[model samples]
Target: MYAQCPDCLTVFSMDAETLAQARGHVVCGHCETEFDALASLSSQLPPEPFQQLPEHKSSGRPPQVESAVYRPRQESALAADSGTTPAAESEDFSHLVFSPRFARPAHQNRMRRWPWVLACLVLLLLLCAQLAWAKRDALVVDPTAGTLLRQACNSLGCRLPLVQDVQHLRLLARDVQAHPSVPGALLISATVRNDADFDQPWPVVVVTLSDVDGKHVAMRRLRPSEYLGDGFALQRGLPSGTSTALVLEVEDPGNKAVAFEFSFE
Candidate 1:
C-alpha cells in the first residue's frame, strides 16, 4: 500500500508492519508532518501527467507529480528510526482550541478613548456654566458661589448685575414730615441696616401712606441714588452689618395721607 503526506504530498510505501508501528501515525519522510497514514492509503499512483489537485476536493496538501517512498527515511533509515514522536515535535501544532481576533496595542486603545473623555469633560463644564447663569440671582448671593462666579466673570470680562438681599435689610427707623421750606411737600427719612455678613446692592425703600381708617392713600419707591444723593454711597451699596440713613422728598398726597409704613425691597 502507499500513503500520502497530507502536508507535502510526498507518498511513501507502507506495509502492515510499518503502518502498525505507531498505530498508523507516521511522519512524512520529506516534510516530517505526522498524520494517519492509513487514511490516505492507495493501491497505486495516479496515471502520468502530474497536475495539482484541487485542495478542497482531495486533501489540503499541494499536488506532486510523482509519489515514492523517501529512500533514506524508509529504506536505509527505517532501522535507525525510533518510531516515536519526540517531545520537541509538540511545537508543530495542527489544531487550536480557539482563535483570537486582531487587537490594538494598549496605548492605541487608550488613544482612541481620549476624545470621548474630553467630550464628557466639556459637557460637564457646559452644564455647570448653564446652571450658574440660570440661577445667577440666587447664586450671586452665595459666598462660595459668588466667589466662583466673580472669578469666572472676571476671566470672561463679563459684567455681573447687582442683586438685592431685601430679606436681610431691616428698616431701623422712619419719619414722614412736611418739608420745612418746600410747600405741599413731604420729607421722608429712614435708617436702613443690612443684617447680612456680606455687602449687598441697595434695596428699594417702599413707603405706603394710609388714612385713619387704614386705607391706602399713596405709595412711593425710592432708589439708592435718588434718596442717598452721594454717588459714592449709592455705588458702594449697603455695607455689611451697618446702617445708612436715606431721605426722600415728594409732593404730599393731601389730608388723606395720615400714617405711613416703610418696607425694603
Candidate 2:
C-alpha cells in the first residue's frame, strides 16, 4: 500500500499482508523516519484483515517467519526502480500551520469593554444630578441689594404709619420722616399674588432692609390688603446722597420665596 510519513515526506510501498498487521507505525527506508503510517492509509485498506499471504515467501521461508517480513527500499534502490528524481520523493510541509496565526487572551477581550461601561455610568449620574437640581424651588438673590438697604434704615428711625383694612399683610418695617430730625422717607412697594387655585389665605411676601454690613436694620411683611390692590409697602428714611436697595420677596403658600431687589439712588 502507498504510505506517506508525517515527519519526512517519503512515499514507499509495503506488502499487502505486512501492512495489515503493522498497526499505525511505519519506518521510512530513505530517511529512517518512524511515523504513523496507518493515519493516511486508513481510507485505502479494507476493514477486514487479508486472508492469504504472498505465494513466493511460503516455500523458501514461512510467511509468518521474521525473514519473510517486509523491508523498506534503500534511497538508491527506490530511485533506480522508479526511474525518477531522488529529491522528488521527499516534500517539505513544515509551514502549513504557521501561515496565518491569530490568538488573543480571554481576559483582554473582557477588559476592553470596561471603559464604555464606566463612561455610560458617569453620564447617567450627571443627568440625574441635573434633574434633582431642577426639581428644587430654591431662590438665589444678588448680594448687592441686601448691602444697600441696611445702610439707609440704620441712620433714620422713621417708621411709616400703618393704614388699616390690610388683613393678610403684616407691617415688617415702616420708616417715615419726622420733621427735620428725620430724613425724607424712601417709599418701597411690594406685592404677593396667590396664584394657587385653593381658597387659602397665606403670608406670601417678606421685605427686609439691612445696613451696609448685612445686619437686619428693618424688616416687614407686605400683608395682603382687604381691597386686594397693593399688598405691602416699606418706607425708609434716606439722607442726602444716601442710596438704599429695597429687597422685595414674594413667596407662595408653600414658603418658597422668589425675591427682587431695586436700588434707589
Residue pairs whose backbone atoms clash in candidate 1: none
| Model 2 agreement with the true structure over 133-225: per-residue lDDT tens digits | 454222111134323333443467532222122132323343322234324333344333322211123333445545555555554555434
- Assess every candidate by TM-score: 0.52, 0.21
After superposition on all C-alphas, the RMSD of every candidate to the true structure, in Å, is 16.8, 23.0
**lDDT for every model?**
0.75, 0.42
Superposition TM-score, candidate 2 onto the true structure: 0.21
Clashes of each: 0, 16
Model 1 lDDT on a 0 to 1 scale? 0.75
Q: Per-residue CA lDDT of candidate 1, range 1-265, in tens?
A: 6777778877777766676557888988898799887677765667756442223245789678787634323432443486655443324333322212223357877888999999999999999989877887788788887778778877999757667778888888888899999999999888878887556888777888999999999998877667777787677677778987778897799999889998877
